[model samples]
Target chain A: MIGIIAMRDLRSLFAQPLAWVVLAVVQGLVAWFFFSGVGRFERLQPQLSRMSDPPGITDITVIPTLDSAAIVLLMIVPILAMRLIAEERRAETIRLMYSAPVSMSEIALGKFFGLAGFLLIVVALTAVMPLSLLLGTSLDLGRLAAGLIGLTLLLAAFGSAGLFFSTLTRSPIVAGVATFGLLLFLWVINFGGVDLGPLQPAIDYLSMLDHYNAFLEGTIGTEHAIYFALVTLGFLTLSVQRLDAHRLQT
Target chain B: MEERSTLIEADGLQRFFGPTQAVQDFSFQLERGEILGFLGVNGAGKTTTMEMLTGNLAPSGGRIELNGCDLLDNPRPAKASVGYLPETLPLYTTMTVDAYLRFCARLNRVPKADLDEAVATAMRRCGLEDVAERVIANLSRGYKQRVGLAQAIVHDPEVLILDEPTKGLDPIQVREIRQLIRELGKSHSVILSSHVLPEVEAICTRVQIIHEGRLVLAEDVSALRARMQHSSLLLGGRALPAPESVQGIQGVERVERLDDGRLRVFHDTQSDTAEQIVARAASEGWGLWELTPERKSLEQVFVDLTGASESEVQDTNEEMAA
Candidate 1:
């Protein structure tokens, strides 16, 4: 059932122009970031060769481009996920999901996987820009792989949270705004006042930036993986619960 | 323990939103090969009751059994046996008719091997084969309605629930949809809710009138007509007998003359007074152009059963007609 619904959602997503527009804009921005980083690295390479320890192209051009792709995805993914459930509810097609033999969990997870699949395609298209630098430079393949993993997990987390808010309302605009607000809050919560003693670590743990920063440096720690995994599961479960409650509350 | 032949049995179904009692004590039993028409005024909780039966809304208190399976306790099998077309047709406007039906078929757990055949059959049944490749958003309202019905029955459920299936349709489209529904009723137990009394009288085998969130009356259509059998004859002609002369006939209860050169003769309910009136008129050479027995329309029965006054019923019926 999840596979079936996921395929349907993906099909519907492509049927509309929003997905194509978002893809075009994100790729344009990613390509721009990649070329600028390459130009900066080219200028800095002559001076850095005299130093004892010189940063390679991966550290200067590829990592920053990957990081920029993550930032671009964070802003655009809510738009992709907004229509997953909210548009269905608004258009009254959500009743088909409610009355079908499939469970609420399957519906929620199907939508989550569907948007995640689209985001993965976007991530892969963006990765081609960084991977193309291998023609003239020795790129750190391991770090690039880690960053891709981290970005995909983060996209899944964002997709799940966006889906939760979508289930909460019938307006896709409201769902998009609410999801963007939640993701922004999670991203900036750790940058509050520096005087907190006990809550500092907890706030840092909740922040998405801290976990994603570790993958940018090629460190694949279980802690960050667990953080993304737990957050994804939490939002997915809440979405399922919200869907079940919708049947009851309506 | 009883061998239940009832396809759908909803008892004491109640749904309340905050302090408003949307529906209460609504109960009905739908058997196989039955086309039950649920009639109610707007905001009379007809849609709420249907949402409960279709598992879109949970009742505050009720027990619904579908084909011997408890709806609440065992929703999967119960839901699998039912197909629902909501008031606003649930459709993905971007999808083609064939794709949407296939999606609905898979969602309802139709096996992979049977998916194509199921979609084809549903399209053929709903007369949607001609525009199977058209995007749903581009289709006309009638075709959209047919697509809705096709998606609902793609899984071949045993029970089908339609909420105002023919609402907002033109005369010809309404006839087409009603014909499709009647054909579907032959194989599946159908529960249709509508505000149009004539449509109900035309298609439904049984009529269930609901008012103020309660089941006011439930009976076979023929039985309901029989209950309102007020042996009245409408005699129309240029030179009809006087009202008093018609009243003098045996078994005649009362007589009144209409403005349009017609005599309405009320007679004993147990007698064939209409036959006698026709014979008497024929023998008297009163220019009997027409002698038709008047069965109280479902509209009159609906108004009387709903406990609304004649004027209020007229207002709503006029609204419905417009």
Candidate 2:
């Protein structure tokens, strides 16, 4: 049932021009950043050759490019995921799912996976930029894989949050703005708690960018993976609960 | 025997939207091969009751069984047997008609092997085969409604709940859709809601009238037709006796004289008022020319039960007659 709904959602997303526009714009920006990083690496190579130990091309170019890709995803995901449930409600098509035999969890998870699936395509397309460097120089395959994994998990978490916000309203514009606001707050939450000695660690643990950065640095810790998993699962569950409540409130 | 034939049973259903009570103590039983019509004016809880029966909304307190499966306790099997088309047609406008029906089939758990055939059959039944490849957004309103209906029956559910299916259509389109619904009624139990009394009278075997969130009347269409046999007679004649003299007849309760030299007499339902009036006209040299019994249309009955203005009912009756 979940797969059926997910496929339907994914197909509908591509049927619109918004998804294609987002893909083209994001890929254009990523490619520009990738070439700039390569230009900076070439300029520093002669100075690095004189040193006994120096930063490699992966650190100088690839990590920064992937880091920018994460930020780009953060801005564009809400645009893609906002219509998942909110548009259905606005159009009154949500009644179709409600009247069907599917469960609330199936609908919520289906929407989450559908949005994540689209974002995965964006991440995969970004990976090609780094892989192209294999034609000239040796690339750090381990760090590249870790960066891609981090981006995929980050997209999943973002998609779940967007899906939950979408379920809260019948207006797609409102859902998009709310999702973007909440994600921005979570990204900057680490800075807000830096002065509090006792609360700093707990607050820092909630920062999505911190966990994502650890992956970019090639340190794939269990805590980082768990944090992403918890966020993804937590929002998806809340979305299901919200949908179940609709049957009573309506 | 009654239990076996009962396909849908909703008992003591009540729903409250916060402080306002939307529906109260609404109960009805639908038997197999029955097309039940829900008739009500706007804000009469017809849509609310339909939503509850379709399992889209949970009633505050009630029990609903579809095909003998408890809707609240075990919804999947119950919902699987039912198909619903809400007041607003739920269409994924971006998808082609064929694709949307296919998706609905899968959502209803139609097996993969049977998906194509199910979609094809639904399209054919709704007359959507001609425009199956067109995006739903491009279809006309009547065609969009057909697509909505096609999706509802795509999985071949045993029960179909449609809310105002023919709403906002031209006369020709309405006729076509009504014909389609009547054809579907042969194989599936249907619950159709409409404010148009004639539509219900034309299609439903049983009719329910709801007013102010309460069911004011429930009767088989045949029984209701029997009630439509009004106990009033229109008597026209030259040199007729005064209305007061006509009122003195044994079965007559009241009499009103029309400007056209005709008298309308209200009488007891079981009495032979017509025979008595005929006897008086012959013996008294009344020269009776016309004596016809007035048959009340369903519109009059609905208006009388709902307490709507008598003038409005007359206007609609005149329009319908024309």
DockQ, every prediction: 0.74, 0.74
Error of model 1, residue A110, in angstroms: 0.5
Estimate every model's Cα lDDT from 0 to 1.
0.88, 0.90
- Per-candidate alpha-carbon RMSD to the true structure: 2.3, 3.5
Candidate 1's clash total is 0
lDDT of 2 by residue, A1-250 (tens): 9888988988998999988999999999999999999999999989999999898989999999999988888889998888889999888898999988989999998888888788888998999999999999999999999989998988999999999999899888899999999888888887653488888888888899899999999978899999999999999999999998888994
Instruction: Estimate the TM-score for candidate 1.
Output: 0.95
* Candidate 1 residue-wise lDDT at A119: 89
Pairs that clash in candidate 2: none
* Predicted candidate 1 versus true structure: per-residue lDDT over B38-89, tens digit per residue: 9878877999999999899989998998888888889888889899999999
lDDT of 2 by residue, B147-218 (tens): 989988998988999999999899999999999999999989999998877799899999998877889899
Question: What's the interface RMS deviation of candidate 2?
Answer: 1.0
- DockQ of structure 2: 0.74
Candidate 1, B198: how far from true, in Å? 2.3
Q: What's the C-alpha lDDT at position B63 in model 2? A: 91
What's the interface RMS deviation of candidate 1? Answer: 1.1
lDDT of 1 at B312: 80
